[model samples]
Target: MDGKRFQNYEAYFTILDTGEKPITQEWLVSLIENHENNLQYAPDVWREYIKK
Candidate 1:
């Protein structure tokens, strides 16, 4: 993993114990990276990121 995603994963295990807070950018980015690494990055994707 790249440094940014690696840091995010680290924080996920250690610091981000409670997922009650609003999602961090690192987490969001990591999710996208996991789902679709081939896609181009775009800030607009965040507009509908958390729909359940």
Candidate 2:
């Protein structure tokens, strides 16, 4: 994964686990829509994690 993706992953996991200023579903949806292609190329771990 790229450094930017790793950083996003770190930030997402941190917010997910700590429940501190968690991301909103709307924002998440927007991100997905904006990065659909990038996400398709992302690791399986990310795909499965998002499915949860």
Candidate 3:
């Protein structure tokens, strides 16, 4: 995966785990939708992760 893309995902995950601030589901969905084609790995990865 590209460094920048990984950074974005990591940042989001960090926010979720820390719970310092809530991230909306729509915002998370939008992030994945915007980068669905540009990031590495198949879309199934995102689908599976988000589905959890």
Candidate with maximal TM-score: 2
lDDT of 2 by residue, 1-52 (tens): 4545433333333323423444446545656676655564444555567788
- Per-residue lDDT for 1-52 in model 1, tens only? 4545533343343233333446456556856676564223423334345332
Ranking 1 against 2 by TM-score, winner? 2
- Candidates ranked, most accurate by TM-score first: 2, 3, 1
TM-score of 3: 0.25
Backbone clash total for model 3 is: 0
Q: Residue 27 of model 3: what lDDT?
A: 50
In candidate 1, how many Å is residue 1 off?
Answer: 48
* Pairs clashing within candidate 3: none
Q: In candidate 3, how many Å is residue 26 off?
A: 0.9
For each candidate, what is the lDDT? 0.44, 0.51, 0.46
| Candidate ranking (lDDT, best to worst) | 2, 3, 1
Candidate 3 lDDT, tens digit per residue, 2-38?
5454333433332134234444565556567765543
Displacement of residue 30 (Cα, Å) in model 2 is 14
Q: TM-scores for all candidates?
A: 0.25, 0.32, 0.25
lDDT of 2 at 21: 45
